[model samples]
Target: MKRMLLMGIALLCISCQGIAQEKKEEKKQFPITKTDAEWKAELTNMQYYVLRRAGTERAFSSELLENKDKGTYVCAACETPLFKSKHKFRSGTGWPSFDREIKGNVAFDVDYNIGYARTEEHCATCGGHLGHVFDDGPKKTTGKRHCINGAALKFVPENE
Candidate 1:
């Protein structure tokens, strides 16, 4: 009877562990909060162009767009942290691209405005559109080009 009780306890522990793992994932995926007017006032005209208007930055025009630094990228509109430096890659597309985001930090929508199928990225917090993503990216890793507008992001340099 003691052995049976021990096995039951072990099963309970495993179940609780699973629940904790799921909660962590849930927290990561949730969006941050902000208003459109607040973002407009906080960001500049250029930032407003790209982030709020879905405007694309001119090729090779942004310092952070090509920044190869060790840091995280956050939404210039709302300061919601998004991608990590590790996910950024040299796409040679004259824009900053990332293979992925910093988990639960962003959102995507289908863009067909150009009569082409593409994925549009956005700040999950304010629903502010950022840019598009493509599959024809780096061959070595996740073949995704998070072709972001430089105005949409702000680079937070790593302390180390």
Candidate 2:
């Protein structure tokens, strides 16, 4: 029947759209790129896992959680300034939480690795996976919580 044939074609077109989206994500390119071997040589195993492979560190395992010093957090891979010390907060989520990032230094994307969409944040310069952002934050502030992996960042003290 012509109706049946049209339905099948429509289904095929819908499936093709899904495939195209996956391909687009696979081909994403960053401004700063390096060979896998070079990244391996330059980073520690944990840093490589978190930054280059889009991996998450264990909760409550980062020393930055308890850090009270004045400084800025930079991307471990590219040294891009991410969050300032003043913006950091205790979100009790076992990760370094920030009220915001330095404008234009961080980039946002969607991740579905957990079978749901999450707002993924990354280093704009190197495209390293930083972490996720949420809406539950201080009401007087940006109302954004940037829950970042400490391994994906390097702290630079203000005095230094």
lDDT of each: 0.80, 0.92
Total clashing pairs for each candidate? 1, 0
Clash pairs for candidate 1: 29-104
**Candidate 2: tens digits of C-alpha lDDT, residues 1-160:** 9999999999998767554355353656778999999999999999999999999999999989989899999999999999999999999999999999999999999888998889999899888999999999888899999999999999999988
TM-score: which candidate is best? Answer: 2
Q: Write the per-residue lDDT of candidate 1 for residues 67-102, one digit (tens) a residue.
A: 888998988877788889999988888888899887
lDDT for model 1 comes to 0.80
**Candidate with the greatest lDDT versus the true structure:** 2
**On a 0 to 100 scale, what is the lDDT of residue 51 in model 2?**
92
Which 10-residue window in model 1 sums to the lowest lDDT?
Answer: 20-29
Quote each prediction's TM-score: 0.74, 0.86
